[model samples]
Target chain A: MSGSIAVAGLGPGDAALMTPEVATALADATDVIGYIPYVARVAPRPGLTLHASDNRVELDRARHALQLAMAGRHVVVVSSGDPGVFAMAAAVFEAVEHGPPAWRDLDIRVLPGITAMLAAAARAGAPLGHDFCAINLSDNLKPQAVIDRRVRLAAEADFAIAFYNPRSRSRPDGFGRALEILRDVCADERPVLFARAVSTPEETLHVVRLPDARPEMADMRTMVIVGSSATRTIARSGAPFLYTPRSAA
Target chain B: MSGSIAVAGLGPGDAALMTPEVATALADATDVIGYIPYVARVAPRPGLTLHASDNRVELDRARHALQLAMAGRHVVVVSSGDPGVFAMAAAVFEAVEHGPPAWRDLDIRVLPGITAMLAAAARAGAPLGHDFCAINLSDNLKPQAVIDRRVRLAAEADFAIAFYNPRSRSRPDGFGRALEILRDVCADERPVLFARAVSTPEETLHVVRLPDARPEMADMRTMVIVGSSATRTIARSGAPFLYTPRSAA
Candidate 1:
């Protein structure tokens, strides 16, 4: 049994968004490894083993998956959104960078998914229709100064911003600091969207102005989008549609 | 006889990457409208009408789709990637903004898909693992000045930048100009990935340093990614895996 590993994205809480490629990988896997909730998304099979670990131990989990692959198991590591975007793909590669040289040549692949930002953008009427940047708001991996600088520069570039890991239990004040920076650099009336538990049964989307945007609106499951100056809203009988025009005026 | 319009993405080129939501929209569509190549992707059926148009007619195509929906057809407007990102969703909203007031009440929705940048990033080992921006390099809708400025600012932000519509027939010189700006602003040895026709049988991926990257390497089908300063490549016995580490070292 030749060993190999695949890092797959399940998308943001929607099985309907899972690709056939990802589905095929899961069906063919001899073992699955991931954070607890993501591992729970997979089903039990006769020949497959599940390795579910707690959060914030990404490096350890990645090394374990690699070890399983080396032991002749077809291991599949799963993440909620696209594995490449602030997710497992980087951590897996980080492990490979420092791990044994033989692990480098394993059948390691990164399968893409419909990330949470795209799902939230679709639901909110394409605030990312124009130029945009995605920033991971959590400072667990990087410094706060880097986050603050990126936010200011993204605003100055007039790019719509999508923020991942906006607010988690361990870091409650990060989103508040992000909001303060955006307020200082961006227009006061710019529309900000807080998309919580998107594409799930608990999905809720709230759109507010820059000044009125509060930190507490977002939780661990929330994806925040701060629109560019050109982003606009169309009020109607239902929730309004927000989009940035294709052409710059 | 109620009318509605759903703007959908077919993903890059692979049917497996298409979401069930998008598939559902296509199955229920009474009429499908898009550019020639995109519309050709839809299978022929007795009841579903296919309307394929020429290039550079986004506004016209959007109007036609809206008209069909107004005439009690369940119309699906298709784009190559996610419709909300640099595609049909923004155009449809633009029409509604300037067209009849009743158009505001139309049931228009944006269906997400696996976008080209994400697909390319996954195939290349997550070059966009950290903060990144997506910029459309086409100068048709916006002036060259805007694109130039955005490229410069994105480099200053040290973001892994994804360039969509990087090269086209009439605008062959546009990508060359972009390369010049990037070379001037970014590190000389920064990695650049030119992913052509990703997720398709004809797909080809090429990675080179910034100075070694040429405009001729890309076509209309290519998605160009320029790595940030922190982007690194892990060389193996096989092909190298490119990625920007999750943490700032």
Candidate 2:
């Protein structure tokens, strides 16, 4: 008897934000698999098996979770943000499709959660109110060439951009390079919003011009949003928010 | 004694997608105020006061909810998607700022929830994998000049675009005008993904080129995602998904 699998979103932070369906799915699961921090989000429940690993081992962890589900154990694959938005859902589906035959029959559902971009946008009074995009600056899984191309395209198009996984100790200059690409195509005065650890205790939101932005301000936990050509920063009560409208109206 | 206010996001659709926090908030609220359809979403909980109205009266409803909150009645202002994403959250804030002085001391925490764009992107297998923007095609709140400018900017920047309130019974050509602006600036062959009632039982998602898209297929409930220059559609298992990459790698 193969048990089903649910890939649940834990949301930005706080256990209360978890959907009731996600909570029930995690509670009933015999095994839970995710990156270490996300796995820690759920408190210890009865009859639960935990699989946690570093960032590099996500594919393997997903496969192992699927295997557990195939072995007649309920499993919940967890992700910090929406699983499908550069989170674990794609890997789960990829593994299920390319993995062994026995894994094919397992039930799968991808539950939605609060994404960092949206949380950050909300915190900053709608930085994403207009046209925008999100780019992960980490070059580990993807190449620098590709990141450069997307950044150039986003900049050239003047789409507001949110930078995820923007910086880490290993790749100090990746964000810098991406920023350069954006600056080249967009105007120097474009607004760049930085939201670090959005919704968590350490959450911080900064709205600044492109020239004033610094790479040291971001980290793995930070999400960066850059405004489009039309995004304007108005000083209200000494705090600025980025807003773009559907129309000038 | 002032009653607290709860800001809730009803996910794209499907009551099961409601987060535990949102569910608990809705369940515990004495009154829920929102557009009529959103008010109907809450399960018939005992002791729940429902304030439903037409779409045009959102600001008025929000003011009424604030009055309830000031009068020491627990009230929840509900938005169908994430309250912040072109929804009720901003209106709530606006009302609080401009409403009667009695509302000044009230505590407000803008809770996070799923946005339709995110849910639609998830259902479409990551059309938002890279960078993107969401533009509302409705011209009621804004002018057509602003809409055309933003659409052109998004296309020039090559940002994936999610169009909200794309079409309605009265303004059937709004989406068509948006498409015209997009086509003028971006390639006419850009991929456009359409998602309706995302995450709900009536959810539907399809991908077509911009040139082939028809305004007749869209309505108020529709969300149209137009891919960037780099976005590509791949056929998998007899279904199509728009794929955008963080990097070409």
Candidate 3:
């Protein structure tokens, strides 16, 4: 039997956020591969084998999934959010590029899902309504200088910025440094959203001004959204609604 | 006899991509309000009233929906993609902000979906795998200079740029001018993806070098993605895979 690999997104910790296409792909796959948490999300079936790996072994995991597919096993590589956005899809292609030329022709498809930023945006009140930039703030794979430069330029462009992997145990200060850079360029009290574990039971949203935003507010599960200059807050009985207007002068 | 408003996304013309959360909102809604085509996407039901409006009347439509909700009607405002991204969520919030103070207490939520750029990115490879910025190219609400500045800054920052509403008949030259500006800053022949009517029966994807790209390649139905400097293409028998790696030096 010929085999294929589908890199699917299991959207922001919510089953309802998952696309039906992804659900169908998971049902058809013979093997599932991903980080432990993501792999745990897929229900175990009699015929399906689950290979859950630890964090930071993306390339190795990608290669393994490809190897299995080449061995005529339909494999599904799952990521917490959209695989294309800082997830397994790129790594899968990177493996395909380094592997046999024939491997490039394998049936590899990236199924998009509701990414964390968009999920966080929905939980908050459309903070990404206007022009926005998404920057992965974990300086592990990329250089800190590159992260800083992107943050500065994004601030200069006045785009609302969504930061993924803001503060991890190892890189606790990266998000703090990013906040300092924002403060230097932007003095306005534009609201910043700290959306943690969105769509989950532990989901907590904090809206603070640039002056009051602390790096401690973010963890590995948090998605930080800094609004554009035009972002505003409308206070209500419950959580305040935040949004950036579509028009930009 | 209670009321609320749900600004939902009808994921790029695909029933499979529509989230179950949005589906639940539609099922619970008493009135559905949106652009003509988007409202038409919802099926006729016994209890549901469809209020389809023309384009360019977003705020008016928003106000009407808000009024319906205020009058104790469960309303669902629909957009083609995630309502938070250049769509109806902001407009609904805007209406609430400008309307009576009591409107703030009304139940308003933004349900996320598979946005156009993400859908297009998945069909193509992970061209948006790295840091990227989303910019709306229509100058109806914003100034031409604003779009120019954003395109230039985004190019300078080396962020994969996603252009929504890239070209309409009335503003044919906006996308062309944006391309010219990208060419001025970026001499490299980065891959430009024109994904038109993605996830629909009329779906067509064109990958071209920046120099060869033309204005007529896009329309209101198209989403244009210009790859970052890190973007690369892998040749295959069927269609080439385009992706931007997750890491940068």
What is each candidate's fraction of native interface contacts (fnat)? Answer: 0.79, 0.38, 0.87
Q: What is the C-alpha lDDT of each candidate?
A: 0.89, 0.74, 0.92
Rank by DockQ (best first) = 3, 1, 2
DockQ of each: 0.76, 0.34, 0.84
Candidate 1 residue-wise lDDT, A1-249, digit = tens: 779898999999889888888999999999999999999999898999999999889899999999999899999999998999989999999999999998898999998988999999999887988999999877475777878888888888889999998886666788899899989987559899999988899999999989999988988999999999999888778788899987742
**TM-score winner:** 3
- Model 1 interface RMSD, one decimal: 1.4
**TM-score for all models, in order of appearance:** 0.97, 0.81, 0.98
**Model 3 chain A weakest 10-residue run by lDDT:** A137-146
TM-score of the second chain of model 1 compared to its true counterpart: 0.97
Instruction: Give a tens-digit lDDT track for model 3, residues A1-249.
Output: 679999999999989999998999999999999999999999999999999999889999999999999899999999998999989998898888788897898889898899999999998898999999999887486778888888999999999999999986657789999999999999989999999999999999999999999999888999999999999899999999999987855
Estimate, for each residue in B63-108, the C-alpha lDDT of model 3 and write its tens digit: 9998898899999999998999999999988888888998899888
Q: Give the deviation of candidate 2 from the true structure as CA RMSD.
A: 4.1
**Tens-digit lDDT string for candidate 2 (B51-122):** 888886656877888889988888888888787677776666566656675565565556678888877776
Candidate 1 — which pairs collide?
none
**Model 1 docking category:** medium
User: What value does the lDDT take at residue A84 in candidate 1?
Assistant: 94
Query: Evaluated against the true chain A, what TM-score does chain A of model 2 have?
Result: 0.94
Model 1, B10-73: lDDT tens digits are 9999998998889999999999999999999999898999999998888889888888888899
Shift in Å, residue A123, candidate 3: 1.0
